[model samples]
Target: MTDLASLLPGRFGHLVRQLGAFGGVGVIGLLVDMAVVWLCLRGAGLNPYAARAVSFLVAATTTWVLNRAFTFRGARPEAAHRQWAKFLAANAVGGAVNYGVYAALVSGVGFFAAVPEAAVAVGSLAGLGFNFTASRTLVFRGA
Candidate 1:
């Protein structure tokens, strides 16, 4: 397969590569988010809203670990716990946007209420750009 970065303009190749890596990590996080939400709802008998909150935290943590290891490996090194905290804080804005869209869909749409994972997918896409930018500039700033 042709490298995605090679298809982009030279000036943007590095950024496109990073975005591709981030997007790959995000896809894993989305799967994690959907699974957690489904399990919480089906196994634990939690409400959709509560399940989503739990799932978001789990997914965010998963993405943070993966992004640190793969997406932004050159990120400034810091204490692991401290970096994790920073990652959470920086992503909160994107998370709120993500959650807001999810909440609206689940509360207002019957289909989304019945299939919350679908809502989760939509919400994740909504927040993708914001999350990528915040993560890159705020949480993972380095060479």
Candidate 2:
């Protein structure tokens, strides 16, 4: 099968590949977020808002690890702790956007309140562009 990068023109191919990889990582992150939220809400007896906050942190950490290992593997190296911190700090805007969407959906919509994972998915997508841009430019420059 032809590679995805080859299907695109010039540097756009590389960007497309990066976006694909980032999207894959984002899927994993969404799963992690959903699972964590479910566990927090059900097992830990937390409110939806509180569960979402906990889940977001967990999911962010998960994505940072995966993005470092796979999505932006070609990026220049730094201390692990430092890079992780930078990743978190750099993606804060995206995280806020993600959380705001989730909070609004869960608070305003009965379906989302009952099915928080669905809200998580929506929030994840809402922040996808911002997260990818921040990851590529600020957290993982040159990748």
Candidate 3:
């Protein structure tokens, strides 16, 4: 009881550090995704959903590269092709989570009716946990 509670805090503290690092990676990835989305949709006249997919692809690639170099750098290299394939698969799931949140906020909440800021806010909050957990376990697993 008491011992379990003490261990819980220690375990949680370690998780907090990992989550923080994971979030730092996510922040950079989000910026990349948003920038590409803006350029493709606003500048190139692509549909919003299509733009989001392309942007997510680009951002996912960037996230993998960065996470390899930073978050999971200590892991012994798996086979190159296998590792990349797994990373891409993980990103596919994360992208689904991300796009779902964006769509829900923008459409379900009528974020388009209220303001762009509301959409961004709601989507970010909704997708944060999915992105963090997926990237941690699937993308950056310790070897």
Candidate 4:
């Protein structure tokens, strides 16, 4: 019998490495989202919630491109656009969950005054697993 690892293509290892790299990309996107949300609310006069929604869109889009290029490099070409749309839809759910969690952590616990970044981090981390799983299964289903 063949080894399970050998059953997969050579790029399987590369895909795993790319997952780590895409995670770094996600981190950058998160920073951009946070900065934009903060600036829009605190500096630009937009409503706080509005700023967060807008920033989330921008960040999710950025992550999608990086993920397509890196994490799922072996994804099928014919379904690429459809996969991206599904990915974005899944991310919308994740983004909403993240925003809700952050809002609760900030308002319910009043952590914003002391550590606003902590709230964002906690929220985003909570949503990360769900997002990844859904994106892999529903969006970029390689099988």
Candidate 5:
């Protein structure tokens, strides 16, 4: 089967390629996040919110490395520590947006009230645009 990005043409091509790379990396990060949350809740017997906090950190770190290496390559190189900090700062707004959406979906919608994970997925997507913009413009502007 043809790759999904192959469907895009013209000015959107570069963005589509970047977005595809980011998305692939994001999937890996999501797996890490979910696994950490599961392990913290099940193995460590942590509260759900506490588990989520830890999982978010793990996922953010993973995504930062991957995004710097692949998705935002060609950008001016900064120190690893500095870049990581910038990544964290840039993503904070996105994180808040994600959480707000998730909270609203789970608490305000009857359908999502019964299936919270679906709300999580929707919330995750809600921040994608802002995250991409911040990563490209504020965090990795040299590219």
Candidate 6:
């Protein structure tokens, strides 16, 4: 843990540590996702969108492993494969929320449409809270 992570408040310290660790895993997952997508697109010559799907699935699995080992260490003991499935199921809602928010923002707001990347960022942020909640409370309960 960094100095910043070490400074987490006493009462809600677990939440802070989990969030920080989750963020780190997310960064790593992003890299893995990008690499997979690149490989699918450039090496396999697959459709760009399909490549994204492949990458997304890979990254989801990677993040589940990382989160289980780090962010939610000592969570309810269960089969590793089962835990990955649970993570995916819980994240489905978060993914929908993110896509819905992105679509709504880009279509409903002229400013957001003009800067689609910003709309995506907003959508991502909107889903973060729900994802964290679901991951901590449902997917990795008893941590």
TM-score of each: 0.75, 0.76, 0.63, 0.63, 0.77, 0.89
Ranking by TM-score: 6, 5, 2, 1, 4, 3
Per-residue alpha-carbon lDDT of model 5 for 1-143, expressed as tens digits? 97666777864777888877878888899899999999999999999999999998899999999999898888897888988888888788998889899999999999999999999989989888778888888887676
Residue 12 accuracy (lDDT) in model 5: 74
lDDT of 1 by residue, 19-120 (tens): 989999988988999999999999999999999999988998999999999888998888888878888887788878888999999999999999999999
Q: Which candidate has the top score in TM-score?
A: 6
Task: Give a tens-digit lDDT track for model 4, residues 36-74.
Answer: 898889898899889988897788778878777777666
Which of candidates 3 and 5 is the stronger one according to TM-score? 5
Candidate 1 lDDT (Cα, whole model)?
0.89
Q: How many residue pairs clash in each candidate?
A: 0, 0, 0, 0, 0, 0
Q: Judged by lDDT against the true structure, how good is candidate 2?
A: 0.90
Q: Comparing candidate 1 with candidate 5, which one achieves the higher lDDT?
A: 1
Error of 5 at 86 (Å): 1.6
The lDDT of each candidate is 0.89, 0.90, 0.72, 0.76, 0.88, 0.87
Cα RMSD for predicted model 5: 3.0
For model 6, the stretches where C-alpha displacement exceeds 4 angstroms are 1-8
Prediction RMSDs, each to the true structure: 4.6, 4.7, 6.0, 6.5, 3.0, 1.9
Better of 3 and 6 by lDDT: 6
Give per-residue CA lDDT, model 6, range 41-134, as digits (tens).
Answer: 9999999999988998999899998998889997889888888888888777888988899999999999999999998998888777778888
Summarize candidate 2's per-residue lDDT along 66-111 as a digit string, tens digits. Answer: 9999889989878888888888886788878988999999999999
Alpha carbon lDDT at 103, candidate 1: 98
Displacement of the residue 90 alpha carbon in candidate 4, Å:
0.9
